[model samples]
Target: MTVREDVHSAGIPVLCQSCEARHRGVCGALDPDQLVALAKTSSKHRVEPGIELIGDAETVDSYSNVLSGVVKLTKSLSDGRQQIVGLQFAPDFLGRPFKVESAINAEAATAVSLCSFPKAAIERLMKESPELEHRLLKQTLNELDEARDWMLTLGRKTAAEKVTSFLLMIARNIDPTVNPTAKSATFDLPLTRADIADFLGLTIETVSRQLTRLRMDGVIRIENNRHLTIDSLSRLERRSGA
Candidate 1:
């Protein structure tokens, strides 16, 4: 069978059990017929962290759902500076709705799993499936809200606050099997300090320093340079004033 056929039949493998009918997918709005149509128009791929997912200002064949891992959406100025615009975790859609046909040069910050869907097929699904359309609308609204919140992180939060918020957000987005808070809740620090710097509007050194401070202050523990463990989540949350 074809890849599309396989994904359609299997559905997304990374759903969270506690909430929502679909995780990291848009199939909640699709009936079997709509699913079949979608199944005919999607593909899956894996990529390591630091690989590029979409090129800047480049159009693509389709959109994607982040099945596993994390994606950092970003842009660069005329100078050499780069800014990570957003983060997309498992069960999240990477592309925008009814906006740009191509990405603005987004990249994966970790080993990522992706489900691709043809834009034409998505448009077709939207037209024929009102539920799918409505679901997509809700997704768009949610994204907007998230963007505004990120703006607050950038504009208002402290270095420790940014790091804490990022860690917490990452924790909440993954599957429970991953156990984000377990015995320190080890998980990959998908984005590098440089990526964090850009995304959070701080210097790379600041990011590094903040991480070190978090570790030293008994707020977190670093493992093998990639996985992060929250030593005292309550303290960290207090740091964020959350």
Candidate 2:
């Protein structure tokens, strides 16, 4: 039987049985009994776009798994300027472990669903579950790698390449189950053009120009200023200079 089948047959919590986080996220490291223990203190909730899930320097009381939608992570300067630093998708674990406070602002980039557990519960489980700690460590390393790659995007890539790279990143991450060779993808822009500009280090007009250029070149299709469809993922990747 498949691992999922095993998990289900083992009678894990019904809510966890169907969660992407449980199957593909940190929770995947857990056994059925551990899941049951974690679920006893977990809660699922949804937040609308623009809601702050964690504030900069705020006390860290809980951690969450992104069940759906995107989360925008940003850092703010003392002078009140903020920059979009990272984006998290479903199945991505939220919160930095072993930290007393958040270093960045975590806001719902779109309508988001989260399964959250108290910091104490997760930390306790980490001490008891080596696999859980491994999963978290792996995810943290992956994020570091991604952040480095993004530094290349911001510091070296041209305006057009940055925009294309941004779109490709979203298309690739928006759905974890999307086949790597899938030719097409459809999704709404989780961030507005202004936000995209901030993330990509470009002016809003430049971002718009690149999107229009991509559309004119038949690389992607846009609707109502938000919905986007990439007819050819390979083509988009090429445009991204990847």
Predicted model with the maximum TM-score? 2
Clashing pairs in 2: none
| lDDT by residue (tens digit), candidate 1, 11-55 | 433322222324325766777666666766667777776788788
Q: What's the TM-score of each model vs. the native? A: 0.83, 0.94
TM-score of the candidate numbered 2?
0.94
> Number of clashing residue pairs in every model?
2, 0
For each candidate, what is the lDDT? Answer: 0.71, 0.91
- How do the residues 1-242 of candidate 2 rate in per-residue lDDT, one tens digit apiece? 10112122235778787788988999999987888888878877788898999999999999999988999999999999999999999899999999999999999999888888899999999999999999999999999999999999999999999999999999988876677678899999999999999999999999999999999999999999999999888889998887
Best by lDDT: 2
